[model samples]
Target chain A: MATALTRLPDERLAELLHGYRASSAGPRRRALLLALTIAFLVAVAAQVAEVDLPRLWEHAGAFFGYFDRITMLESGAGRVWADPAEWFWGWRKWGVLLLDTLLIAYVGTALGGLGGFLLAFCASANLVSNPWARGAARRFLEFCRTVPDIVFALIFVIAFGLGPVPGVLAIAIHSMGALGKLFSEVVENIDMKPVEGANAAGASWPAMVRFAVLPQVLANFISYALLRFEINVRQASVLGFVGAGGIGQDLIEAIRKFYYNDVAALLLLIIVTVMLIDLGTERLRHRLIGALESRA
Target chain B: MNRAVTLRDAAVAEMAGIAARHPQQFRAMPPARLRALALFLASTGLLVFGLWRLEFSPSRLVDGFGQLVHFLGLMIPPDPGTWSRTMLILRGLSETLAIALLGTLGAALLAFPLGFLAAWNTSVNRLVQFLSRRVLDSVRGIDALIWALIWVSVVGLGPFAGVLAILTSDIGTFGKLYSEAIEAADRKAVEGVTASGGGKLHGIRFGVLPAVLPVMAGHVLYMFESNTRSSTIIGIVGAGGIGLMLSEMIRTLEWGVVSFIVLLILVTVAVIDTISGRLRAALAGARAG
Candidate 1:
């Protein structure tokens, strides 16, 4: 085959390869127009966003400069790794707050996931016969998710007087909105055979849902909840910035006070915690989804 | 005929044999169900414990709910305060949109090259891919809010810091996502380019990019949608965006104004979602190549 292909002229081979991608000019024009539109929007964005190219060029060093400083130890011992003990002088306090962050995420995800699971049935068009009920549920979930969890945290901190309570509530509300939407979508796409079977058997609405829908959607619900849990952990870490509780308070303080080493340590801790949660949740989700797939 | 006197006897014998062989299966529930029950109970217990530790007692929760309800009551008939304040909110919202747009664009532009470095198929070597992927992963682990806070210290504040923050975190995300798309691109195109005596850059330009650009564009559109949300919150950290107006209103006990800003955000979000959804659909459906 190679000898046969080599027998062809160089010009012929080039033509064959080039012709493979030959097309009309219409798409190229469309793509060019798209590019021009994006470029125009970007120009307007630069003006509105106050993106001064010269300013950015001048102060860009400070960007990397901050990272450089954060890596340095408080004792002037080069980097954090050089003198790990001094760099992590406040690890004990941070560790406790880290635990608080984790707990807050745990409670938030649980409450949120539970709330979503229950409300999803109402929101799902296929499950709830009442249009008003489905619309109300859908709108509530949309409102919950639309409002940022941190914004909720800010308000709750004010109303509840600053603690993990506000943080958990914030996460829970946001998660419920997000997970509710996902769960309802999952329910809408389920096979209707079992549902019809149960209906024909004269099962009541609740019984039909319990027997037909729950089995089909339970694994998906758990998987979505686990994904939400991973996100909640990240949010929980930052809730303290609003005094809603967790390590975020200290983190903000460190950033504000120019405690570079401390900032570095806290960020590392937060990232590591989030990464760990992500890994665990990912594994659980895979197993749940994999088992469901195998079962089917 | 002599052995089986009736169908009922044969059925009973078969049932007994099956039950004896798989007794657990004959039980009311499977082992999997029991395990699921256990897992549920364990997680519930943990949640309860965590809530307790967070000081979420029933009384406190009730009290908190009451206060929140009162706050809601205070928010009745949303007010925009003075016309000037309303203008300020509008300006802030516009600024937030701009920040998201610029930051996302910047991140995409910057990440395009780094993506080639990180992708297993396009990198110069294994070491480069490994290092680039790890670097991207570490940077992405830090949320955009944290980046905003950090950038505030660097650039002192304003939309510049906010954009930088968004740009920083998004570069990590976009690079990783872009590289993944690159990896998923069909290799046959690249081989065809190579067979035609195309250079490395030529292969990537003519072979890989055409396949992955639309996918990357879809990802970029999604990123822009999410970044708009991030821009709002980053402003709360003292960067330039509508979040500063939001936090200010909330802190000053201006419930009406807070509700108004929130309503504005909700409307803006809905609008952006609709537009982005359409663009994404167009991108996916169009055969630009």
Candidate 2:
């Protein structure tokens, strides 16, 4: 570049030096074109989703207005803050329902976690040499997870009658499928050396898993199970919309009946509960992971 | 004694001598076994309490099994009623897809900037970052179904409400996820940009954003895949999608139609999952390249 520049005039050298910014224009134009394409796609999606600007604008007040109404208590009361007791008048009933939701999440997670642990071994390619059995197990887990838990709740509600039973069963089935896939993946990633040794020793299948697979995957499995429990608590709350169980039934009723204050109260309770569970489970999972790593 | 047997005997004897010297090594359970046992007992108690309070019994289980079989019998054909009904269900499926697409796209767009605000290293100020993080947490803490219900009450129902509901819920998730990804990015490139006399925004755009865009895009694609599932169910809350149709069919006791819709949903979601999986793989490949 020094030799080439020495051959050039000062005018040309200055021009070339100043021309660096112009080189960037190519990428700038390309970025603009890309942005335009994305904008076009976004517009198309908005149209397909039936986004109405005028309607949205017209209902803007109503949308925000609902929040105001929910925060409000009866006449003469400024808001939910005006009287906490009045806002949570049905706390006792809601509390019982909340407990029911927690129980459903607990039992359902336990049942599903056990089912997943058993099935994961069969589904893992490293563990099960039978292709057909592995494929069937994979497909079964997929089917369990693919269907929304609420749909399962609806079907179970019809089959088992309206109560927390269907809710628990729905959560169990969905969690089983979800956790089975995860557990199998964990099994697939384990150190195969221990498994090879166990096999060479003529250990039975169950014995091999207990000594080789379980020890390696137990920490990950427990962490995932605890995470699923946190999710299931939130899920159990929603199962009630189908009359399966949980506080969701009352929450739905409040929405339908336009009991704005009740809706706000119930939503607040649910949000707080979910956040608390998320925090608690997250700490436990980290601790479990730490213990596993230290042992290794 | 045979050579192999004598060798094995000597090894066993040595191991026994070692065990005698350090007995703890042969203990069956780990040091934390007591804690584990207590945890097991507590969980078992909770499970028993759950079953008792929820009124579960062996008789109920047996009856439920028979009733479930009867329901399966009703769904053997998996019919979708008439041709017109099939078309309606197909259209509902499309609406659900549209809602998921628009919602996820909107969320990705909104979260792109919010990511910078929420990320610790790139945030404008610590207080703003903290506040934004809390806002995103609370927003994400409320489930998408609840958002759909709330939006339904506001918008009076339809796909738009579903779109808004998904958009709102996903924004919080994407924001938190995007910030975490950003925070994990190497800061050397960003420092190089700033060292070259670039402003903070310039540094972020040229260094941080380019580095994390793939991870962020991958996350957005996964969110789209999951949102499709959420949109399918949000309709049950009257947010306007196949869920509303599903709930309606269930209400009218058209078990065949319900089964048919469920199958359609399963197939559609599987297809979406495959497509998004491919896109994410390609994105990763591009990043590697």
Candidate 3:
């Protein structure tokens, strides 16, 4: 390759080198431009958001200091484990509230999963021939998803008079939107052969869906629902801050009232619970997919 | 031998007849049939019991739903209130956007190095990788709202607190996601670079980064979209944003302002969604080409 390049005519070699230089320089120039643009955006955003470097520098210690305070032993106390009873004094109450949070997520996911399952068929363009119906379904799901679950909780809290019911309903609506979108996508990508077979046999729409679509999408639907459940658990805790009822009520109170140790304890419980749920659901989803694949 | 052959023929005929008569029933039961049935029943029971515990009465739902309809009716012709109030809301909206953008940028910057450390293939040591992974998981386990609450106390109320909250949460998320992207990167380029006597860092710079940059950019843009929603929520917790205005309006029963604010949020989110969607698509197309 080097000998062939050296034997080329001077003009041809000059042209080749020029092309090589331009090709290399092109990306470098583009990278520089992109970097400058991003830097400018960041600077403006920092100004608008009031993210002062000096302020952060001055207050950085306080952030760590707060965590230090949360971990500090109470006056006259020895260590974290020395007074387990004192540290976890509110454990029983917090445990109940945590359970309430989990239950709320469970019911909400189930209800929303059911709702999404029912709506997914209509929402899928491949399954639903009527463009109008599909469009309407898609729009409704979009609206449901566009509004944050917290906002829905606020509305429901007022209507339901502040309890887990509002939280459940809010989660259900949001999850329906989320799961419906996912389920429809799964439906759209399924094997068309079974659907065609069912249709050719003069099967009804419901029968065709049951025989063709459900069998294919059930595993995916369940996996998505499980993931939604994991997310909903976190949301449920946050909903409690809006008076929807859960451990978050206690958590926000602890923060507001500066119950430092209680805050730490509650955060620990929440973190541990969420992690456990995440692990369990991950295992379950894997098992579910494995079974489905093996069966297939 | 002839008698045995006759017996086998008779058995085969009997099986075919049964299968022809009951095609569906002839299929063997799935191994998971019993487990699936039990799971369904248990799940249904749990749902029912949970509904009861939560006091989800049908009559109550009907009654509350009626009130909700009335409440929604009052939301029509969403009022922007006085010009002064409108200005405040617009300012708040801008603050929310700034918070999201800055927070996402900060998180991405901070997570970049941490992601390399956390990636199994890139880490300097197994211990560092393990520790970084755990740190990411634990930090991410805590919700952004909780972080906001902590920051509000640490930095006092304002968009600064919201930005910090978003930054902290996104650091955990981006660290995990970016590391996964790096680990999934194609290794052939790295191998070629090494074969040419390139240093480890050079291999990463030329090989891994090129493969992962588009994906990382896509993830960051997606984070910005999500952080916008999160910033609004954190604002309600006194972290300072449009959410504070929203909560205040709701508390005062300012249905008009509440509806107006909700509409503003919805429109802003939709706009961001569209822009980010296009940008991500472009990135993906670029990667493909």
Candidate 4:
């Protein structure tokens, strides 16, 4: 094959060789480019973020030391398991706070889910004919979701005083925005045949939405709300740090006071609660979707 | 012929009578409707009870709204403080970005192997996969703020602590997401590699990794955007970032400065959102092309 190619023509051989080289070198060249870009980005990020290797090395021991302390029993105590009572000494108060956190999430999700349901139809471009109304609803939701719930909690804490009430409102507003967007997207993707049928029957916009759009998007809306609830639970826990009320306040206090065992205990409780919520919601969401599908 | 006509007439009359008797049957609510109605009523009751328990009275809400408006009024004409203060804010903003970038990158790098191990298809052992998944869940259950508080104690108060906080929390999240992505990868490519006499590792490297990289990169970019928000908030707990400044200003009731920082954050986040959106689209386009 080589002798035949050489016999054909010199220019043709050069062209074939160039074509083979180009094909072979394409991936290698792309890989090299990618690697170089990554290297440059990493170097810049390291400098800007102040990721000092020497400092990290020095503090590595201290980092593990803190974990060791958290796990350690009291000064004279033996193993952590031996002092179960001491470990979970503040269980009652923390438990109450955790319950409060869950309640906050529930109320917030309900309120937000309601708001989302109300606004989603108006926001959905496929449903709402008026450009202005759709734009307004979309912008409102964007503003709601854009500002972090923590900031909302901060503001509400100022207005409503330091309690779970502020946390509830904050979560509600943020969830409304998040769920609204999702719900609208669901509405937008619905089969328009039912909507057209409703319209043909001389149904008003609200009636059309109620009779047609709601049925189609209800399953998806619920699913998104459940997912948001999962997120709001996590958010509610942290809201307590800002005095909005939850177990987070206790967790932060334990850390600041050097209550190492309490910190560990509180963390475990929070982690367990969150995990349970996650699992429970996942199951509930799946079941709800399945039921909806079966019904449809 | 007369008998047949009478029989047909009788049958038509009987059908009409049945339809008239059960006129609403076709449009009637299903048997499950009752259960759905009960569930809705029960949920509404629960929601009302929760509101009452939380003391979320309408009057109180109205009153709070007034207060909120007053506070918002105070936030008008956001002041950037002095030039030095402006510089300080800029520096904090930069730190927040850096923290997000480095934390996300670190998490993606660390989670890659763990994700492979956690993936059901790729895991060497079922027990190992189960344990890895549980660990990710437990760790991820703790929010980044909590992680920040822990790291602050561990590494002392600084942006380093902030970075560590984001790193640890993101590791759990990225691990779970990456593993899911890995698990969802098409097996045909892997089978092809194996059919070509490649080993398992070679199959994964040449087949699985290529399929999942784009998805993983997308996740990483998204995480970077979110981590920016997280890094800001972690600072409020004193791990060190713009959040520390924000909380401090809020404590002093410096509404103007607080407003300024809030706007700064909003703008930064918006810009990041655009950039990440474009990058993702580009990446998707490249993959498709």
**Chain B alone vs. reference chain B, TM-score for every model:** 0.92, 0.93, 0.89, 0.89
Candidate 3 retains true contacts at a fraction of 0.64
- Per-residue accuracy of model 2 over B191-268 as CA lDDT, tens digit each: 999998899999999989899998998998899999999999998888878998898988777888888999999999
- Which ten-residue region of model 1 chain B has the weakest summed lDDT? B1-10
Stretches of model 1 off by over 4 angstroms after superposition: A1-25, B1-22
TM-score of 2: 0.92
- Model 1 TM-score is 0.92
Candidate 2: DockQ?
0.71
Of the two candidates 2 and 4, the one with more favorable lDDT, higher being better, is 2
TM-score of chain A of 4: 0.90
Model 3: how far is A132 from its true place, Å? Answer: 2.0
Q: Write the per-residue lDDT of candidate 1 for residues A64-137, one digit (tens) a residue.
A: 88788899876676888898888899989999999998888889988998899899999998878899999999
Query: Which is the leading candidate under DockQ?
Result: 2
Compose the digit string of candidate 1's lDDT tens values, residues B1-289. Answer: 6665777777787997879898988999898889989998998889878877888788887888999999999998799989999999998998899899988999999999999999999999999999998889778888889999877776777888889889999999999999999999999999999999999999999999989988999999999999988899899998799999999999998999999999999999999999999999988888463
Q: Estimate the TM-score of every prediction.
A: 0.92, 0.92, 0.92, 0.90
Clashing residue pairs in candidate 2, if any? none
lDDT of 3 by residue, A126-226 (tens): 99889999999998998788788888888888888888999999999999999999999999999999999999999999999999889899889999999
Clashing pairs in 1: none
RMSD of each: 4.0, 3.4, 4.9, 5.1
